[model samples]
Target: MASQKIATLVLVLGLLIMPFSIASYAQIPCNTVYNDLYPCLGFVMGGGKVDPACCSGFKTVLGLAKTKTDRQGVCSCLKSLVSDATDGEIKNAAQIPKLCGLNIPYVISRNIDCSK
Candidate 1:
């Protein structure tokens, strides 16, 4: 009887939680995340590969700069994100706005492929 009750309770809990879980798992906009990120990266790398350690610091600084509406501060912060991201991720992220149908001429122009 105890086992049966436990099973029933588990079933009820699962059913109750399923909808919220589904809603919570909704897709995040990678383009937005990338847009928010790549500029900072460019500021960091200036024109080089990204490093992993710089990512966390970049995110934190970017968050703070964003709150204050400081473009220069945000650019300063991107220097770090750019220093941290892998070369591949940086390249991929640069392409995100275009992939999302955004006319990010400035960002796209910065890409190595864009000039070639």
Candidate 2:
């Protein structure tokens, strides 16, 4: 009976931790980019060295890039998105999406300028 109870406890613990573990891993992309790029650019940023918690934060900024009405926040999110991108890709203008306008072309370009 004791052995069975221990097994049950282990299983429950594993189930509880599984989602959190997965979410942490998911944040690796953002974290890696932030750590690498921020130092060179002179901006202080960290997602705890690419652990799972960073991934949860990653989604928030990514979602902001897609549909947030706050234009300034959207521009700020760009640095996070491209922070992990390869060096060659960074210079390529076509690769970056233009967050100008729905129709009239507002051109919110300055907010995302992380380049030196």
Candidate 3:
């Protein structure tokens, strides 16, 4: 319950503040990014095989990140999505892209510098 509350707060905060964080330069919306990546939660939060749906979503989200700011906004949304994740969970999450056979331009981590 406590973790759920934290997750909710992080999502809400991200939704509320994401625009200000990347609005000037980002063309993609965090909500869209959120919806696109939600499918990966199962594999990311759990120790299991990655789903094809999650990979499909992953491809879509990565495809949308066309610019530096777009990537930053996507990163910010991803951080919010897994804000309550344990270190192991984050590691699992980070492996999804590679497991899906997709390459990204940024490092996947809880401490990712979205500004970069």
Candidate 4:
């Protein structure tokens, strides 16, 4: 159960690490970020097991960023979601990448600065 909660938080955190610029991401619009993230919301908000589909979506989204603008865009998006999370929640969420066997360039933390 504890692991489940952690996994849930991590999935949501992972969702905030991708870029969605249509031109850069092969026409992936920013709004569609929500579509991929939809399934993880319930788990992220309520605390439970993270879904495999959620991780799959996360992987696809994470792969979209390929430039500085992309990183900044993803960072901007991450800031909003990170704001609503508690320290513990953020810690758990940051663990998603590792849990999913992925390595991201940036660290997902509450204090993360999007401008960098």
Best model per lDDT: 3
lDDT per residue as tens, model 4, 13-57? 555454543233333445455466556565555546777776776
Location of the lowest summed lDDT over 10 successive residues in candidate 4: 18-27
Q: For residue 89, what is the lDDT in candidate 4?
A: 60
Backbone clash total for model 2 is: 2
Candidate 1 C-alpha lDDT tens digits along 13-69: 343333332112223222233344434343333435443333543353335433322
TM-score of 2: 0.25
Candidate 1: where are CA atoms >4 Å away? 1-69, 103-116
RMSD of 4: 7.0
For each candidate, give its TM-score against the true structure.
0.28, 0.25, 0.75, 0.63
At residue 34, give the lDDT of candidate 1: 38
Q: Model 1, poorest ten-residue lDDT window?
A: 21-30
Best by TM-score: 3
Q: What tens-digit string does per-residue lDDT give for candidate 2 at 1-116?
A: 55643543354334333333211323323333333222222111211223333344334444433333333333333443334443433433122222111221222232354221
lDDT of each: 0.37, 0.32, 0.72, 0.60
Q: State candidate 4's TM-score.
A: 0.63
Worst 10 residues of 3 by lDDT: 16-25
